[model samples]
Target chain A: MEEKNGATSKAGDWRSYERVLLPPVRDLHRLEVYEQNGGYEALREVLTSDKWDPTSVTNEVRNSGLRGRGGAGFLTGLKWTFMPPVDPNIPRFLCGNGDESEPGTFKDRQLMEFNPHLIFEGMLIASYAMSITTSYLYVRGEFADWISLMEVELAKAYEKGYVGKNVLGTDFSTDLVIHKGAGAYICGEESSLMISLEGERPYPRAKPPFPAQRGLWNYPTTINNVETLACVPLIINRGGEWFADLGSHRHPGPVLYGISGHVNRPGVYEYPTGMLITDLIYDVAKGMRGSKKLKAVVPGGSSTPILRADQIDGVTMDAETLRDAGSMMGTAGMLIMDEDTDIVSWLRRVTRFYHHESCGQCTPCREGTGWIENIVTRIDEGAGNLRDLDLLIDLCFQMEGRTVCALADAAAWPVRFTIERFRDEFEARCRPSLVPSGGVLTPALGP
Target chain B: MTDFIKDPVILMPERHPEPVFSTEELVFTAEETRQIATWVSQYPTADGAIMKVLWMAQEKFGFLPPEVIRLSAGALGMPYARAFGVATFYTQYFKSKKGRYVLDVCTCFSCQICGGYDMLHYLEEKLGAHAGETTDDGLFTIQEVECLGACGSAPMLQITNGPYVMNLTEEKIDALIDALKRDQLPFFSSVTLPQDEDDLGGNRRTDVRDTLTYSAPPVAKTLG
Candidate 1:
């Protein structure tokens, strides 16, 4: 609950922290407007001058403490270092994951929609860092409109020599293709995204071949989230130390907090990480709708564990604070619930989403999600028994850590956490067991 | 009724349905072929372009019938089964015929909390079609979908996988349905943050024409 003064100025104002990802530049999606506002300056500086090189760029990002904004919060610079040292004979690839399908997460969509060139610019810088010639920006199929907008902007970037072959008239060359994903949430998982790019059913592959080593046609590949890559230019421009100093020391840098549900004004707000969750729910989002008391919160996306209102009293939005508070800063898509919200029904709907979207790749995830949804549905419908609650918990244990990807874990966390945290609500809905726990039934002698 | 049952039924797609498009109509145009070629060259192998090609096919033919999927696979020179599996895996690539306007009502957690189901039920009652069913008029299809990532503007529905009509009320739904019946698609409304209203003069992006200011979510008529 300790407040970090990183985002506040001497005047103790929250608005003092400026927006880097979604800047206030008018028509920034346009290449000309972007260039006028120092859009490609980072890429230009990195490409043209001998002052910067690939390793230095990676080092700079590492120094910035920029974590992947997609969900995992892994250091972007460290991830860049994972690529097997570039071989002239071998080809390397980078996939910009724009599959922002996680529910309660819509920051990437707005970022992609408004300031596309920044993403393209970031991609160019990333390509130069990794010696990648071609990169794919994997956008979800639901974002067809955003894809079209990016396509127009990307073509404009290409025509202006900002992207495509020979970026900025230098020897360094890179190309970005906008790959549209069909409506599968699993594709947001990096390996599955690679498989989807390879024209397969988007099943996540087992790790240790880990995308950095082998991916996309079995070549060396690196996939960074869209927002993660978007921060690269700022890291390059402002110097890593400056970028690292903006947010919490551990998880520093500006983050787009997509606050939604039951708030008076729910929208994507850019703020430095480590802003108090209370400040976010109250001051930033303009408090609860209808002056209702806070009930519960899904601190990150739907996948992250839901926390009771009291649990988030002094918690900040950074990954470490949220993790310590028993929820991860997952995509920073905070779903706020008011006192009137129905926990059981909400959990049921969330379980149903996991069931519906499970790729059916692993038996645990495929079967477990369906089973979990069914149990929750029955519980929500006032069906029998306290044992079912135990069964739900048991099913979560069985599903977690048993699948190839984290999808199973993601599916289990919300169900397990919601039930564990809101047991009273769920228990109230269920009828007691017919048989006493220690009582034994007499066998029929005639039989 | 509870979804929990001893025997769960798995609905299968029709193995062989009547062809919606003729052989002549099924073929991609020369321009489309060239566009497909550009996409094909973008990838190291033709397989990588399968999704994009299938998307293009879906756009051209409306939905991916078996023959159209085959056509797409044939265009990419990949296996038909592979194309079919890819087609079936993703929900957006519709395998069957749909009404002109598919109202994908988002009833995910955030939207659900903010009357997503209420908006869905309202549409169901008004249109006389349950979720996932097309109206007899063949103009509208109501679908209860998962999140489309527009949680900020909850209780929203997308029109035929295009523009999102967000911040829904019964009146807005009525107007939307009326407009759609008259062949009007909703324009994309960029919902701005409250912070932007205070700092950036209401909107950050000046290029966007239609913008919506975020407001308090409406209370649900039914929590379910």
Candidate 2:
């Protein structure tokens, strides 16, 4: 388990590095351009190739060991297998989650905007694998531009007979539908995404009646992230083994890391999933914005716990590796903060996001997210008492596993981590001098 | 001094009554009807057309008044209660009147640290309207949002009915507002607008990859 920073960590050998989704070409948003540059080749192969049925395609993916790129690294094959036997009498469906609402994440938008057909090819493969002849791509509102861009590309695909009846001159017919989501982050969650498609309030549903078992108008369905589905075509085009061999152990294949914040160059970097955090920020991102030292990093999306600069050393950028380092690679959206950052204020803003996003489904998340934000806001405003420090962690603990959705857990991570790892930073900002006379602190300190 | 639940914007956004459509019968023009029909054609079940139908109504009549919601409900073949529920639940839909120019500032963690709050204050001072308040002349409204998924730009604001302005500074804000008010929005923010307007169209990449890269042994050679 040897680890190194910057230059040495990446090992220069990019021979296996594959950019299936994001290619280094411009004007590819148009169908003609995309087709010219090897787009839709996988779908054409799948339709016209020899003896490749649903089970074999699923087996190829299973062998590839491709995990869901959407936060939970669940094996795509295993999840697809979870679907109850589809009654041919009733239609089964597949939904692509284009609801890129996760804060600190923007990879999906880039993929869809630039290479829309890649998503379509991926959907075509997925539809074949699960016998899901009909598919829907769900892009949320406020992303009207994304909806517009996807619509244009989808039209071209349909007109070319790539999608819609008798695709590529085959008996199997697959139709691709695009669904627009109203502004709701919870809808990005699979269960909620199903409900949103049915034109309902975007509240996440309970599991056990998982979408795979019964989804979208009470039929069996599978929902995957936009990036996850976009990878399917690649898996089909390239051999699964070659795809699996693209990354470090455990986390395999190329991933789109949306690196943002105080870095000199904040852009999406397509690389193997397990690049070191230092390499992404220092080498690939070209270093911090100014002369300031790196202080903290949210190695995943905003919901993930912040890793102190020291903790980021040798930390590979993947789900298992990040989880081993006490954070989940939920979206791989690294938000970098510099030394001059006021950590308490930053955490307060983070808490505010979860508070705003909590769907009010369960009492704990409904109440606890706002409670954490309030306490953190109090601390940032120079009123946090020593006991309030414990209060923040306790509130987060109560909220973690008690909610219907993971939004509660997302809210809890930043609070618990900041209190546990950066207690001094919290203490430095807990200005007892600003605590009201004979108020919130009087009972704890004296009586 | 309790702030456990005192966030006005989070708890209650500034609301205006449903009057625009109440004053007259809500009707879609032939063009709007054709657009709505096109969106409906994409879905197998018409229920999937609700969001897009709402988008059509909003486009025709700036904000989604109750009457417009009703029209969208009818267009999607869903009940009015269901359409209202969908409309009220999401943040993008405007139930009330909005200024001609709406500025939705993303104040989430990534944006906050990178001068999002500063931009908020500057907008408030310049517009004389806080987050959710429309200016007297009905020119501008500043609203707060969780995130726009543009964290790569740090602090950013999306111009409603227009494009997103990213990596914003105070002076840039002034220049943007000037161009916007003068109705001469020249080429400014590359983060939102199309790349070349001719060739590489639709939300082109703005910043180049500036992070330096380090090399190690090949991933396949080392791990495989």
Candidate 3:
């Protein structure tokens, strides 16, 4: 993918060849305007038209290579394919992840808030594909308006015959309900979400009986992120080939790259995955918003490693390249930090959030994130011995991929990366205070 | 919390003799009410549908006012406090009063890392009140919220009545505020095919194909 360096008279600014994602200024967030602007048409088509086969819809998405936009970047279609074929005789479910709790990730919230109809359309399509009569949009508790938006639109959908039984006058039918989570980050994970939806403690269940085969009341179900569902209609309308052309084969389709940090044009830029980091960082965002020097960027939200200026070049906002650089695009949450920012303090803050949100279900994450938080906090507050650095690093290693879910790993990854790439900084910050104490030995290093 | 959770609304036509109010503060159109009833009937018991019904009522009415909550409670055979607790517990369901348009700023960890603080500050200044406080004009209210899940676009804010403007900047914030002030909300592109042409006002007769074809593709617009 080619990158553009500067602005042009043409809307041709970001890339010589890129389409402005979901264009045309509609009512800022009103469902009425959404209706006026061609929202729910695809769903109307699928429900009302003769060609409403759910299998072909799933096939089109599978061919599109559109991964889950919420985080993890897993293939959306592949996940849907895992659904035990929906038997109308049985009850199957689809839960939309409105729980956008991942640190440095907010794309799902945006998708629902701005273009709620997109999710409604996606929900209907998925329900139609999976033959699910009942679907739920488990929106985060914080999006007060979005929940309302979903309600209004849902009401409209039913009134218009786009939802409810005999949808669009077809034999197939699905009903969508918007459920709200009580402000918990852990709920973003599928099993945890299922647990919460089932009115239990928000604890994750063991997988392989993954949500697809056995989920939500122990029935076969499909749980998807808001963005993943939002991408469904596009794949159906534009065809898989056209969708694949947007990003790389490995991570195809247009990704909503949310550029932040000290950039002038910080906003979500929808583009193909392979767009070069240098072009995105400097040109598209117009560099750091203030005069702050670019120090590092937490490449795919806080869960991914922190990348310095040198690493910015050649980086692609896709899964494989991000992994090659020793980071996963856990969620396409790119948080940029400048030289003026304090990395230690930043990590401490992020760690604190994770600690508070640990859910305490797993011993590793429940205890591990808490320990990391204490060490990082001590380090940030300028009361740490050099030995504390290694201790924190060791805890991170132990925590990675060890828990029942990714929460522990999400908390540990940033700490691990910060220590490895910026150990000297951590050491320098800790040593001066320690030297004054005349300590004979440092703290033990391993966890 | 227990009571609110048990019964999400207090007003109902059956349980209580009178309507929730003499006049509807947030009147639902006949069509909108029918939509609500359709969902209400889906529950095995009327009380089971209280949470969703209140959600629909709160949405129809700007805030879940006392009357509305009571009405919902009565309708669902729920305790008033139970309805209140459910309404208050979920941040999405507002408990306090609000302006005609409320701007929910995303202060989730991701947005915080991505200039969310600055955005909140900017909105506070623009709205002339701190978060959770409505503006003097009563046209707008600004509040900070946890993740709206647009992590990709940090520093974003939801103009209560608008989409999530991600990768947000001060300039974008300014434009959003101005647009809200002018009631110049962004359009929402969708199609509505009424069950019957006569079900709604004559407004239900547009061709979705023509309207959708002329509209910009889904990815082009903002997600609030």
lDDT of each: 0.88, 0.77, 0.68
CAPRI class of candidate 3: incorrect
Give lDDT tens digits, candidate 1, residues A291-329.
Answer: 999999898899999999989866888887778789998
- Kindly indicate the candidate among 1 and 3 with the higher TM-score: 1
Which digits, one per residue and each the tens of the lDDT, describe model 3 over residues A1-447?
333321111122335444323443434245567667666677777666666577878888888888987778888888888988656576888998878777666456555645677788888899888888788888776666557666876787788877788887878877887876656778888998876666445677778789888988788889888777888877777778988877665787766666555565554556667666767767666676565678887766667788877676567677777777677777666776667666776677678778877878789898998889888888877777777776787788788888888888888878888888888888877854333323334544433
What is the Cα-based TM-score of model 1? 0.94
Candidate 1 chain A vs. true chain A: TM-score? 0.95
Model 1: per-residue Cα lDDT at residue A191: 92
Please give, for residues B14-69, the per-residue lDDT of candidate 1 as tens digits. Answer: 67667888888988899999999999999999989999998898888889899999
Residue A98 of candidate 2: its Cα lDDT? Answer: 86
- Model 3, position A161, has a per-residue lDDT of 79
For model 2, state the Cα shift of residue B103 in Å: 0.6
Per residue, candidate 3 scores C-alpha lDDT tens digits across B21-53 of 457453556786676576566533355355566
Candidate 2 C-alpha lDDT tens digits along A1-447: 334333234323543454566765566678888889888888888778885888888888888888888787788877888877757888888999888888888878778866788888888889988988889898877676667778888989999989989888888798888887767888888888888888787788778788887898888999888788888888888888887877665667788888877777676767877787888888777788774699999987887888988888778887766787788888888888888778887888788888888888899998998889888988888777767887777788788888788889888988899788889989888755334443233444531
Error of 1 at B30 (Å): 0.7
For model 1, the interface Cα RMSD in angstroms equals 1.2
Most DockQ-accurate candidate = 1
DockQ of each: 0.69, 0.30, 0.13
